[model samples]
Every structure is written in structure tokens, then in C-alpha cells.
Target: MGAPDYFVILAEMRTGSNFLEESLDAAPGLKCWGEAFNPHFVGAAGRREMAGIDIAARNADPLRLLAAIRERTDGVAGFRLFHDHDPRILEHCLADPRCAKVILRRNPLDSFVSLQIARRTGQWRLGAKGTARMAKIRFEPADFAAYLDMQAAAAAAVTRRLQISGQSAFHIDYDALGDVEILNGLCRFLGARGPITAASSRTRVQNPAPVSQKVENPEEMAAALAELSAQEPFGAGRSRSLEPDRGARVPTYLVAASCPLLFVPLPGGPRARIRGWMEALSPGGAPPLQGMTQKSLRRWRRTNPGHRSFAVLRHPAARAHAVFVERILYPGPHCDMDLRESLRSHHGVPLPEGPPEPNFGLDAHRAAFLAFLAVLRGSLQGQTGLRVPPEWATQSALLQGTAQVLLPDRLLREDMLAQELDAMARPFGRQASVPPARTGAEATLSRIHDPALEEAVRSAYQRDYMMFGFEDWRPEAAG
Candidate 1:
């Protein structure tokens, strides 16, 4: 309550985090340790230990290092946390109200260009006396688009965690990093007695030229920027021309009529079973409420005093296959005919002109699914012309979108749905067994699935696998 016991600068690579750390360290009794949770090294590059905790020890228990930093420091202690750092420590930091959050951001284009230059020049940092290395890098639209998506995802995750926990963070942009007053204010936020007299001069800005001057293919870069600006006018991640942002699908939220329970549904998951379970919770088996807006959702929450919200997650492999079969491989009421055509012609997905023939068997299914996965890899990275439907978008991205309106209190996995749902329902004096697991798609997938398919799915949904810690899909593991 009296200033955070510790602090973390939530940041990403090439976002001036190092400069901010230098500035914070200038204040007396305000210590900003380097990236203590960076998985590649202990604290800083080429270092193995920090505050007596070595790399092996820290990996075994990151909290041991955190404890050391808090206990050994003479004043407020903190570290920088990039988006790709150890997520276990990130979870602990976000959950602890005593951990002050400093959110740092830069323009996605600038950061992307800087990162590319750094990668080419092998110059990540520049000292006052060190000579700066200059390099002109080629900008690839697909690569930049992927970079934007990664940054957006990271920012959304942090924002949602803070919002749900009722915590606030000090946000500073890249251009403000050199302001002495701003640096002093950050020191005050950390409860430091002394003010930062000036911004630290230990580090120098590595790149100071216009983006056009730094990129070799300036004309292509300009064209790409124009296209991106037209597509995402507000900025990266706000909107997309190719895909309807999933956050706008709040109307899909379902609430129970008989009890204070809200179900935030993620498409391509076990929705039918979950909906039936919600209905069964009612005294006379009334249908669950649907078609909720933000205003209506708030009213529902107000009227139901002790409402609990939840969502279920399906394995990426299973989810992707289900979507491919129902929506892509075969025609259905929900299929986008235009998208199917684009996938077949532009993305090299081999699809029949109509529904599959009787001769279409496991081998045919396997080949088509693999080709679809290749397209999925491109579609997710913004290289394809097709829209990314919620049915097949990464679950992590969908959950981020869900956080914009309502973050579920519990996120249960499909494999553990039976027990988890029972436990959740008991607290509200309503108990209903989950309907039997649906195995139609799982049965088909089992026949065509192999290590190759698993690897292909992993390539397409790498973020989901990393975020959820999902293992390879085994038919026996299917619920």
C-alpha cells in the first residue's frame, strides 16, 4: 500500500527499456536491476548470478532470486520484464499488488526497425564513447506484421491482468524516456527519497536517422506502411481490414437465467456441451441467456450479486482440425465461400469443388489438412488475403479480445471439463454433470494424425502452445 515493495518494467526488446533502467538507477535508494528473469542469462548477458542466486538455482526457483533482490537491496528493488521473459515470474509479479508496474512502449515501426538493425549490426547497446554501427536493413511486410501482432498480444495480456486485478500502472512512451522530470516522477512512484537530477548519460541512442534513411527498400517500406495504415488506421492491433476483431463479438457471451453464472464462449471449443450444462443448472432446465451487450452484461452482473464467469480451452490441434472439417474441408451453413475459394486458389489449399467424394479417405484428409495448416501459418502472420475467423484464431488472441469486455474468472480445459465444471457449479448451489464428450471430430483426427500433423499444427499455433504449455495431441488424451 505504501508504494510497491518491488517494481517491474513491463517492456519488450528495442523499446528503450535499458535506457529507462539506467535512468531509474540514478536515483538514490532506487535500484533497477537488469532483466533478472531473462531465460538466456541470470541478470545481464554473460552473467550467471544475481544477489547470490545462480542460473541453475534461479531456473529451479525464480522466487529465490526475487526474494534475494527484495531482501538484499537497501531500497526499492525491481527488474525489467520483456514479453518473452520467463512467464512464471511474470504471473507472480502481476498477481502481487505490491509489485509496481511500469509499462513502456514505443512505436511498433520504430521498434521493429531498430530490432532489425540491431540483429544485423550486432550492436544492442551503445556507450557514450563507443562508436555507433550503422546498417540499412530491408523491411519485409509479413515480418513486420508478425512483429506487430506479437507486441499487441503482449500489451493486451498485461492490460487485462491489471484490469481484472484492479491495479494501475505508470505508462511511459519512448519519446518521454529522456525527460528528467518524468524520470524523477518514476523514482517517486517507487518511494525513493532522492530525485533523479538528470537522465542517465551512460547509454547513447544507437539510431537517430529517419526510417526512410535506414531501410534499404524505402519504396517498398512506404507502400507497406500505406497499406497497413489503411488497414489498421488507429494503430497495430486496434483493427484489421482482413479480419473482424474478435473483441467485437461480445454479444456471444451467455448468462444463466436461473443462477449467477456467465459463460464466455471461445469458438471451435466444446460450446454445445457447455451450453447444455449451463441450461441444466436451471431448476426447470431453462435456456441460458445470450445476446449480451456491454451495457446489458453490466446490468446482469449488478442484478446477480455473486455471478461467476468462466471459459473452456481446447487443444490447438483438436480445435484446428475440427474447424477445418466443419468450415473448410466440407461446405456448411457457416462456411465462408469466398474465403474457401481464396484458400484454394491463392494459398495452395487443395479443395474439391464441392463436398468430398466417397473415395476421400485418411490420406486425402491428411494432405488437405496439412495444406490448410500451411495456409493457417500464413494467415495468422497476415501474409494471406483471407480473414482469420474466431473458429480457428489462436485461443490466446481470442482470450485477449475477451479481456477487453469480460475476463472469465476461471479458464477450464476441455480435458478436465467434467470435474472442473462440477466444482464451479457446487458453490452456487447448482450441480450438473457435463454432457458426454463429443468425439466425432476427434475420432476422424485420430485416423489421420501423426507426428507430422502435430508438428504442422505446432508451427501454425506456436503462440498457443507456448502460452498454454500444451503438449502434443494424443488420441487417448482427448476428453
Candidate 2:
């Protein structure tokens, strides 16, 4: 193995891989060859921006640059080496049996924006400017296609190495701290004496862009991609850009035999626990309450013959829950709008996004809030007081954001909140297909303030209609 130990950090750069390299280098026994294949200070630790580095020299004979970084210097001390490239590089790099590699992947949006800026500003390493080009360069990579190709190349290479060579490989997620966690995990796994926490989280954060743009000009970007991912296209499951008919595929199915659970990051810990309780709670497509029907809603009192009969026609949490469950279940674009990328927030964890610049309203805010509530509810495992009311679809109610909190057919109950929330991360219940309803109730509790004010309500519905192929959010206007 190269000195320190061979560390092939296959990653999407700009997602903090440089910060990771810097951290790894800070340790006593480690060194990094920034990007093995790229032109410039190939072995210079930390970030390499085209603005300051020379790509032409490295391009002439990248090997010389690689050598300059003390490549294989580790062949002696058996020290660790970190290369932040894709897994595919093994095809070119002569493998020394002493080395080990890890595939570190990150959310695509984080990389895409960085890439866009690199291309536009004229200093990308594999440097493809995302800027509008006056003249096209075949391989210069002027658009999203080029970015995807680079990302794909790295991913494919990593996968290939794993299959062909029995390299000690790992798939890592990126953080502002770079690959610290994964690197440490691998070091521990390999029994290497390396410092995992050499760099602090604060030092890892790069100067963030003043404003992270969610939607660029409509004409240049793909509407479908924009709808699915505001930042990066990582969450997309089996659904593709052109295939509208494949909406059902969006809802995730947690068939343990088919798909393995993911290890998401948690605030308090290094790696979040893996569990599946969403399936248990929403097995059948949402508690089969006598879903809103025109006749039943019109004759409210008659439909209310029993205590189990009256229910809020539309529940915000239900909407949120349905959307959340769909993502956890099949994960497709047609399942629900919240599952779409448009809902992702610019600052925080992926919160739902609303309509573009032209139209912004309180009702839309309400709907968005309710959708968030659903996320909270669906994600809850009795961790809090919130629970899906046993008679949720039919009776009992609470205002969740703008939408009513219609409990699932089963109640989460004040008492079972703990048990239910503990069961939050997994799937629950039987599978049932939810067909579209004919119409909504006639009168919407006149308390909504104004009939026209309902236009804002239409924001949630209209957004759903446009994104998921659903009928509407809750159309109460007319037949």
C-alpha cells in the first residue's frame, strides 16, 4: 500500500472532499493526492480551484504531477493515501496490492451548483463551464450533461473496482467535514492507526455562495428535473425525466429483501440509525376512511349519523403523511408533490418548496406548513405527543398547519405516541391503491375567510396536479 495507506476517496468534489483531504493530511501518518487524474497541483492537499492552479502542466503528463505528490511514498511506511476521484480510476492506476479504496458519494445538488459556477466562471478542474456558451466545445463540457458524465464516470469506476478487485471498498456520504467519518470508519475497519478527527467541522465549511439559486432560468433547465430536485438529483428513485407514466414508482417500497435500509445522518450522532416504521403505520394506502365523496360531503349531517362518520374532508397531515409514505414506499414523482424536488428548501433539510417568484400567498404557506406537519407526523414514532388519530380518516380532528390533521384510519392515540413514534422510521400496514375522488365537499366551513382566498389553497392542489399527476389538492369550486 502507498504510504499512510492507500485512500482512494471516490467522491463528487466541492461537496467537502477537499476539506476531508485537508483533515486527513492534518493527521500524523497520512497524505493525499488531491485528484489523481486532473491537471495542476495534483497532490496539493485541500481544495484546488482552477483560478489558482495550473491544469495545463498536469494535463501534459499528469503522472509527473502524481509523482510530485509522493505517489507510492507510502509503499514503505505503509502510510495512508487519499485520492478524491471516482472508483473508475483503477483502470488507469496500476494497483499496488497494499492499498485500499473507498467510494464516497454525496448529494448531487451540492456538486451541481459548484459545477455550474466552475463552468460559468472558467476555472473547473475537469473544468466544464456551466455558463451559456458562445461556442460549444465537444469535450469542454458546457452543460449539465458534462457534469453528469463526470459524476457517472467516477461512480461507474468505483462500482467496477468493487466487482473486479476485492479492494476493501466503502460507499461514503459527504459532509462539510469531507470524508472524515467514512475515513475513520474504514481506518477502524482496516485496523489502521490514523487520526479520524484531525480536522474540526468549522474549518471544513467553505465560503458558501451568497444565495443558493433554487430555480435558474426556466428556458435553459429541464422542468422535470427542477420539479424533482432543487439542489441535487440524489433522491430520485427509479423514476426518469421523460417517463411521466412511471409516477407510481416514486413511492418507496421498503421490501427488506429487495432494498436495504439507508443510514441517514443524525444531529447527535455520526451516523443515524437505520429503521423502517412508516410501512407499519401506513401499510394500506392511508386508513381507508370513507374518503371525501360529493354526496356524503353535501349531506354532512346525514353522513354524520354516527360518531365514526364525521371527519375533516381534507387533512393536512394526511396529505403530508400520504406524500411522506409514498416517498418511503415506492418513491415516484406521481405519488405526491412533497416527494418532488420542488419542495426542497435552500437553507435547511429538504422542506417543500412553493410556486416560483410570481405567486406567493398565505394559503400556500398554510398548505406547505401542513405538508411539513405530515413529515413530522409520518416521521414520528411516538417520540412526541402527536399521533395519527385512530379514527383519523373519518372522525376527530386537529388543525395541522393549513390543512386539518386527519388521523390515519388507525389512531396514534395520546397513549401510544411513544410506541408509534418508536416505530416511525419503518413501514407499516397493508398495501391498498388509492383512486382519485370525483369531487370535493360543497361548502368549506366558510371560515376560510374568502372564497377567492381559496386560490391560495389551490396552490397546494395546483402544485400537486402539476407535479404528481394527482387530480387536485382539494377543489371545492364546482363540478
Best by TM-score: 1
- lDDT per residue as tens, model 2, 1-479: 32333445655555556655555655555556556554224344343432233456556654444444544444311122223432223444426444455555555644665555555545433211122222111222245555667777756755676667655565555532333445576555433556565332223122132112222442244444554457545432211110011111111112121112211111111110112222233434222222333344335435333212111123322343333333322235533344344334321223334323334344543444445443342212111112222212111112121122122223232123334334432342222222222221122222222434343333323322333233323333121
lDDT of 1 by residue, 251-364 (tens): 888787777888888998888888899888998889998998889888888888878999998899999998888888888796778878877776678888788898888888
RMSD of each: 20.2, 16.9
Where does the lowest 10-residue lDDT sum fall in candidate 1? 234-243
lDDT for each candidate structure? 0.82, 0.36
Position 99, candidate 2: lDDT: 47
Predicted model with the maximum lDDT:
1
For model 2, what is the alpha-carbon lDDT of residue 240?
14
Q: What is the overall TM-score of model 1 with all chains considered together?
A: 0.53
Q: Candidate 1: what lDDT?
A: 0.82
